[model samples]
Target: MHLNYLANIGRYIPEVILVLLMVGLIILEATYKEDEKNRKYIFIATLVGLVATLGALIANMSGKAEAIFSNSIIIDQFSTLIKMVMVLGTLAAIYLSRFSKDIYESLKTEFAIMAVGILIGGFLLASANNMLTFYLGIETLSILSYVMAALKKNDQRSSEAGLKYALYGGISAGLMLFGMSHIFGVLGTIQFAGVAKMIPTLTSAQLAILMPSFVLLFAGIGYKIASVPFHMWSPDVYEGSPTPVTTFFAIVPKLAGIAALIRITAVFFVVDSPMKIGWIGLLIVISALTMTVGNVTAIGQKSVKRMLAYSSISHAGIMLAGIVVINDVGIRSVVFYGITYLFMTLVAFYITSIVQDKYGNDHFDRFSGLIYRYPFMAVMMAVVMFSLTGLPPLAGFVAKYNIISSLINSKNYALAIVLGLNSVVSAYYYLKIVRLMTLKPQESNEEIEGFGFLNQMVIVSMTVPVFVLGIFWETIMNLAAGAKLFIQ
Candidate 1:
């Protein structure tokens, strides 16, 4: 029990940061003299918070998996890698807190505080070892995310998007809770291995009472991941929220959701039974349709944020492919895909933030002459788009290769074909954005003023992973393979 408690220390540190940040926010609210120009403090404080969390996580890394709180929470290489990525991702998102439109007064600190809360929850979800732990982690995230999405409370569009999200989020939570009750009632325990171990022994009637509930639980997790058939709220939220906030939605939160998906299914629900294998098939279909639709719909989108939101949903499909396989290959590929995903989406959205700052344009037409004014930024943006399209010599392509090879090795050829075809289709639209940036002519001097120094710093930091990881792809692959989530 003492060792178990010590094992959970990594998971506890992020939450401790959340508490400290909340304390800071309260103190700031009382003492801060609001000067609109002095927003740099917010950036400095947030950067400190995230970097500190990263430092704590780095101190906790090891090759072993350990559990705490009676084995309801786990700390392992899988969760460690995810926690590090999320901390960095959240840090990158908060780097723009100074320029955020919603942080007009004391609220600057609140956004940072709320972001810390979200990070805590996401970390918890990554380490959860039971239904109870999963629900607790997800709700912490969901509660903070609701406030974050609707942070611009004065904006009617933000409020409207919040309402839709609240409705859906509430329903999903209730359904998930109910499912947990059913699982516990049928199996007599909520611990992951407890339920998994009992699965084969259950009588037909018992499984009938629980399997549907199990499916419902997956639905709730899937909603968070924004897979197809339950992905309705994302586009509206992404469109209505600020671009920086939208960037958070595109990267950090989705990584957490995928983490939860991996934990819930890859660790707990896996088996060779036909019924269990059918669930994997469900993932295959969900992944294929989600990716194809996202790529197909992005071509018609005028708003770049909306395009990226759909693009994120599609990539969720690719990540889902990793989870569906339920093996060492799948786990490694998923982690690798996530690392590449951060590079692809972060740089892409960083470009969006830059374009919006310069040209005051979110439309494709505004980017027509971006290359001429900011040639470097334009080229970087084009490379990011190509990587998202899964082209060669980019991290995204390497990620796709790993997933496809894992699928084929797992004998999932039909689904692999679906994944392959969607990658081809996505290239068309990703390149379309490139054409608008380069081949199209600038009708005005919009992009010339878009040199946001803060955004430039963020974009450059985000862009490095794509190239470095592409050149040294083997290193990441080896690390992912070496760090198994459940084999022990």
Candidate 2:
């Protein structure tokens, strides 16, 4: 438990502040009428949330990896960096959620508590070194996500999204649990680093069992990250849930899941023998298929929300390209691309959230003539879309360049070419959004107000990270190339 205290007050600094602030707001509201007096509380909570998270991240950078709670949990640079991203993304989601008044007032306490609970899970995932710890983290995030998706009790779509996510998520968890049992049987240990050390000695028969277990484990991770074959849930969930919650799904959950995957696969996956050949080949095939299918199908989507959903899947494939290399560059590229992916996607979703909130529709055609309706939003949306397309001068392309260049250097140019061509294919649909907004005229001819100040808050805050990170990516690339949580 002392390990928890090293960052101690610093460890959950964000969670503690958010929870306490949320409690204060609820208690104050108990004594007051239904006035809009508590708006200040939410804004202050947002500020504290961001500050505490950033502070903890900075603090963690100076510390060594330590296992708290009798070695069940571990903290280091990798966990710290991933946690920083999750906290920042969650804060952005909270910021974009400023307009959700009724949901905010009615469920203020629950929302805050659940959000902190989810953060705890995300933190646990980052630091998780053992099977029990990983399971605990994944369950915590999943349960809270279900509740969040269902927060709109009056909306049937929200309820349906919750039901489907819970059902699919539960099955994935079960599969993972089954795989853990096999892993334990083969190695007599569930601690990942321990398993990695022991895995090198296992017999061919043991490797046979391990391979399927790997797939089952990958299924659970893929569902969480919305990777292909397990991505059936994303579009429905994204399109059905309220925009704010959907935005949350887009940002933090995806990052946490992917980061966890990188950590586990990089360390614990034992590729020791010829029998283990199957898993690597399987991953390579999945990596190719995920990129090709996600990009190809996304082109036909009419809803911008669903398009982004599929776009995320395609990007996941690109991230997996880094996974294929399995070296310093692969690891760093995952982190680097993960960084770029979060800001680009979150800002794009933020723009869509604001537009949908203002217009009461999210259809692709509705985006037509948006440049005429609100020029600022149109420009911001275009930046986000361009970034997502992996275009030059944006962080997305830089992310792709690093990953593909690394893969090619690793003598995997076939996969690199696939990734490159997919990027080109993806550009068509992403720019299609821009063309619609700029070229087509508004269908109704009735005017919509320029985004109000509150909405602009969401747009401007998300937009800065998307563009600035693209220009100054070198420092991050350097950091990522050298990042190793277990070492200095």
Candidate 3:
């Protein structure tokens, strides 16, 4: 038992570090006075911890798979890749928080603590091999998300956002737990591998119970990914939350949710399962609607942040299309797209926060003549927007191409068409942001100030990868190819 416990600890070093970091942050936050200096320390500590966690995760990665903690957690290249995404996302978010006007001194330590808490949840979700751990991971992430949304205590919009998120999250959680009960009733096991083993033996009556269970479970997962019909809370929450929190929402939870979804789908919807076709059909419809709604609605939004909220929904749909293929290649594409999206979305939100800080709003008009005032930032924003639009020679284009190609390979023609049309439709709005920055004339003589040195460094660090990876697609693609969740 002693050897077993040590083995688990050795295998879970990254998670151990995260646990220590979260506990330390909480203690520090409690012990320290509310002041800017302490807040700065909190921020710096959070960044350093996240960076260390990332290093630990990379160090722990392996081509082989292992089940740790009595098989509640699975460590492999796939989970490692997903955790990397989460750590990187959190790091970007922590750095970005330094610039938020809404996150004052009093909130800073709590903000770092909550972000670390969410990162812990993210790491768990990525490695979860049992249903109980999965649910716990999600609940930890979701509860923190609600509090983060409402951090702007004085703002009515922020309060409303938190309330909406809580209500929606509650319904989703209930559905998931109920579904778990049904699944447990039928299969007598909550471990994914156990469930997968029993799938072939399920009677018709058992399958009827199981199919609904999967759908119910997807309701919770769908809510996390912000898929259609489950995405209504995201835009409002994104618009109302502190900018840094909004960035965290856009990246971290999405990565964890998608990782969990990929695991669930790979386990339950393998080729020989009787319910595979039914689940695929349902995902198809959901994916189509999600992309359509996200793109079409974004066109009407004047606020860039709100529009990106919708855009995120669309991107979720596109990523979902990769899962529909249900092959290792398909999973690889999803992982690659996810990595690309982390950089793209973070840089986009970083710019939005800067714009909001300078102009007091994130509206289209506020972005006018940004080229004349801050040429470097304008170009960077342009790269982000163009990349988001899936324009050629950009990473977004590569990601879209990979997803679409995977769908085509799987003969999901209808979803491929929807994805294509939505991509084209999305260009209009993305370019609208670009056009507002470049073609429109300045409405005032005051120069739009650029971000401070550290902020610029952070944004550039994320931005350069989007451009470099776009040109050198094979590197990430090769890395993603090894990130398959299941082996034949």
The candidate, 1 or 2, that scores higher on TM-score is 1
For TM-score, the strongest prediction is 3
> Please, what are the lDDT tens digits per residue for candidate 3 over residues 1-488?
32486856666888888889889888767767655364666676777788888888888775468887777888888888889888888887877776677576588677888988888888888778999999999999999999999988888988999999999999999998999999998999999888888887779999888889888989999999999989999999999998989999999999899999898888776747677777888889999999999999999998888999999999999999998888888988888899889989998998889878777888989888889977778888899999998997989999899999989988889899999999999999999988988999987877545476777777788899898879899886785564555552
User: What are the candidates' C-alpha RMSDs?
Assistant: 2.2, 2.9, 1.7
User: Which model is ahead, 1 or 3, in terms of TM-score?
Assistant: 3
Q: What is the C-alpha lDDT of each candidate?
A: 0.79, 0.76, 0.86
Against the correct fold, how does model 3 do in TM-score?
Answer: 0.96
Model 3 ranges off by over 4 Å:
1-3, 35-38, 479-488
Worst 10-residue lDDT window, candidate 3: 479-488
Cα lDDT for residue 85, model 1? 88
TM-score, ranked from best to worst: 3, 1, 2
- Tell me the lDDT of candidate 1: 0.79
Candidate that scores best on lDDT: 3
lDDT of 1 by residue, 103-189 (tens): 344466677778877887888898888888899888888888887788777888777877877888888888888888998988899
TM per prediction: 0.94, 0.91, 0.96
What lDDT is reached at residue 94 by model 3?
78
The digit string of per-residue lDDT tens for model 2 on 1-488 reads: 24545444554454455556556645654654565545555556555756776786777677767665666767778778888888777777776665543244555445554565677677777677788988888888898998987777887888898889899899999999898888888888888778878766777788888878878878877888888888888888888877767877876777778777777766764465453355556667878898999999999998888888889888888887787776667778788888888788777877777667666778898788988867888898898888888887888878888898998898887898999899889999999999999999887666554367776776677778766778888886676556564331
TM-score of 2: 0.91
Which ten-residue region of model 2 has the weakest summed lDDT?
Answer: 100-109
Which portions of model 2 show Cα errors greater than 4 Å? 1-39, 100-105, 269-277, 444-450, 479-488
